[model samples]
Target: MFSSLKIRNYRLFATGAVVSNIGTWMSRVTQDWLVLSLTHSSAAVGITTALQFLPMLLFGLYGGVIVDRYPKRRLLLVTQGSMGFFGVVLAALTLSGHVQVWHVYLIAFFVGVVTVVDNPTRQSFVSEMVGPKQVRNAVSLNSANFQTARLVGPAVAGVLITSIGSGYAFLFNGLSFIAPLVGLTLMRPGELQKGHTVKRGKGQLREGLRYVKGRPELIAPIVLVGFVGTFGFNFPIWLTAFANTVFHGGAGMYSLFNILIAAGSLIGALLAARRRSTRLRLLIFAAASFGLLEVLVSFSPFVWLFCLVLVPVGMMGMTNNISANTTVQMAAEPAMRGRVMSLYMMVFVGGTPIGGPLLGWVTDTFGARVGFASGGAVTLIAALAIGFVLVRVIGVRPKMGLRNGMPYVELVPRPGSRAEGELASAA
Candidate 1:
């Protein structure tokens, strides 16, 4: 299960990343709370979130091209350092008592610009840290690592907010970046398994689009993740609204809600790490179930019950996350991996600029429950629609039955070579 941890370089990267990830989560929670404190409006918070993700929509494709052309480690150093610097500046502004909502928005926008490169770079970097054989396990472990941070960071930020201040949480997050920098510096260059970086050329960005446009296996998962990620992953907007508006609670309740989801996600990631296969059918089922759960949770009468509902929601959500990530990474050629992952992320995260504010508006206008239900409903509908297209239109055979005393999903192309050869494995 922990095979990726046996690799020396990957072990170092994971350790440092876990620490950094904790801080990242802390900053995210504090940022949202700080905005809400200033304006007392969910729309303001939504705008902040939107501004932060807007760069992805604008330059994400170009960022992918740059990542494919450059050395990922070097790019990470630049991007990560820039992010830490912004974290420190934001901290200073908050602590000095002169910070404004506009200031937070500006800093968040800068951070988003850095993330446009960092997201794809860091993802494709996993394949380098651990060889191809361990990519799936490494990716799952990374998701687990981030989820574990979510479990701790939000709760810690909540305590820090009530006890100290949000400024100090930002300060702590700024300092946390040092660990990952140190880890990157410590990695032995000789130990790295590097993929071939694409040479810069005209039309390269378009080349990537064409590549993804042709593969049903690839496009299928990307489309699924795009819908789910845009709509299904706006927890900050919904949960904050629920905690403050519905439950009449504070950061503690918000932290509790986040913690339950993280717990489920962590378990789900661990389970995904044990698997060697990434399948489209699994993606469909997990996403559909995740959406269905979110729809149900939106109607819960109590905060505690709502919190309990997040467990299965998080589990199914994380399963879809791992499966989709592994599918895109494994299916793409090494040379095009950066651009491919960038496109995957473009749809998955870039759409946040659109979804976040919409959800926040719904939460602000109708209520958190309605906002949550809308997102789930979109996700479920998309999954069913896409599944039908893949089965009936694209001739995908998603067969699930007992084989060798085990039930599995077999994804096969229509006979006579209509699509990619059998690509899925034991479900």
Candidate 2:
């Protein structure tokens, strides 16, 4: 399960990421809390969230293209450094009492721009560090590491906000980037995974679009993730609002909600790591289940009850995410992996910018309950639609195939004539 950590470079990266991710989560909590404290409006908080993620939606494809064309390691070093600087600037502004809503908006937008390039590079870089054989393990472990940080970071941020102030949380997050920078610099160049360098040309973006268009199974998962990510996974914003308005609590309750969700996510990541085969059918089922649970949780009358449901919600979410990630990576040709992963990142993160504010507006106009319910309903419908479409696209008959024995439609493709001939020859 922990086999991927045996790789020296990956271990270093993982360690640095764990430390850095904690700070990232810390800043996230504080940032939201600060916005709410200043504006006292859920819409303002939602706009802040949207600004932070909007760039990824707009420029993520180009970022992926750059990752495919350039040296990923060098790119990461630069991006990480830039993020640290941005964090420090925000911290300074907040500490000096010069911070305004517009300042926050601008800073969030800048960070989103940096993330457009950083996210795809980071995702593709993992395979280079651990190799294809350990890719699934590496991906699962990476998410586990992230969620573990989520569990620790929010609780710590809550305490710090209550004690020191939100500015200190930002300061800590700024400093946290140092670990990853040092780790990147320390990696032996000889130990790095060499990637295929694609030639830059006109229509490269169009080429990627066409590449995805050719694979319906691949397209199905991307669509499924886009829906779930945009609608169902607005927990960071929704939970914060819910805790404050509905539960009549503050940072502590927000932290508790994140902790419960992260607990379930950690379990989901561990289970995913143990799987020998990552299948698309599992992805669909997980996504569908997650959406359904979100709808159920929306109706909860108590904070504890809402938190309780997040366990299953988090579990299914992680399952869907890891399964989609592993399947996409495993199916793509090595030469096009960066491009495909970029599209995945674009759909996944980009959806948030579009969805966040819309959901926020719904919450503001109606109520958090209705807003959450609407998002969940959209996710459930999308998941079911994608599943049915994939069933037909993959040519999986209802009977006579091994898939019939399973519950959902698996994505593993059948052997072609040449592969069958090769098996006969070996026999």
Candidate 3:
């Protein structure tokens, strides 16, 4: 589980990433609160979220093309610096009392711009730091780092927002970028593991799309993640509305709720790190379980109960995320990894533009409960629908079997099929 950390460069990368990730989460919480504080409209908040992710939706695949064409380490420096600059500008505006919802939206849009390049580069960059053999563990540990930061960042942001104001949180996040920058500079390039990079060319983006489109195993999970990401992952809108309106709580309560979920996610990530293999079927079940948990949590009568339910919700959600991410990263050819991952990120996060406002509208018009329930129902339906498709298109056949005296699912693939061969080692 801790195997990847033994690599000196990855150790540096992970250390720096943890610090920066905390700041990232801090900015996320504070940014949403700031937008809501200024506008008092969930739709306005959704707009900010949409602006932050829109660039990824539009240009993420192209950014992946760039990642494949350039040295990821150098590319990261530029993108990370750009994001931190936006953080600082936003902080300065808020500190001077000149911040507006529009200011937040503009800055968020620019930050999203940088993220289009940064997210996929950083994801695929892991291959350069550690070999494919350790990719699964490294991915899980990377998520563990992010979740651990989530546990700390939001709770701290809530206190900071209530006490020092949101400006300080943004400023802290801006300054925190220095850690990763320093880590990158300190890396030993000679010791790094290298992956394939592409040369400049036309139709490269189309090539990546065609690559995934041709693989049913690949397309299946990507589509399922799209639904889960667009609908099921609209927790920011729902959680904020529920904490403030339904539960009648302030930043502290909101922070506590986030903390509980992060704790559960941390547990799930660590457990995933212990796994020797990942499977698409596990991802399916985890996503379905996550949707069910969300449905249950959305209807919690009390805040404490809601928070308790969030543990399993976060757990299954993280499991689905980590498992799918590992599978996708492992499946792609190294040369096309950037573009493929860019498409994955594009679907996963870029769809926020559509989902955020839709969910926000559902919250504003109908109430947060209906919005949450609707999102979960959609997610549950998506999982079922996609699972059926995978069975039919990929020729998945299932049988009941016993393992350690416990009944388990056994997949019997069609004889002499591509997907059947892929499924043999998919885990």
Candidate 1 lDDT tens digits, 68-174: 99988898888888888998999999899889999999999999999999999999999888877788899999999999999999999999999988999999898
Ranking by lDDT: 1, 3, 2
Candidate number of the best lDDT:
1
- For 218-315, candidate 3 gives per-residue lDDT tens digits of 67667888899889988778888998899998877878888888999999999999997777778889999999888888889987799889999899
Q: Report per-prediction Cα RMSD to one decimal.
A: 4.6, 5.2, 5.1
Q: Against the true structure, what is each candidate's TM-score?
A: 0.94, 0.92, 0.93
The 0-to-1 C-alpha lDDT of every candidate, in the order given, reads: 0.88, 0.85, 0.87
* lDDT, candidate 3, at 330: 70
The residue pairs in collision within model 2 are none
Instruction: Please give the lDDT score for candidate 1.
Output: 0.88
Q: Rank the candidates by TM-score, best first.
A: 1, 3, 2
Weakest 10 consecutive residues of candidate 3 by summed lDDT: 401-410
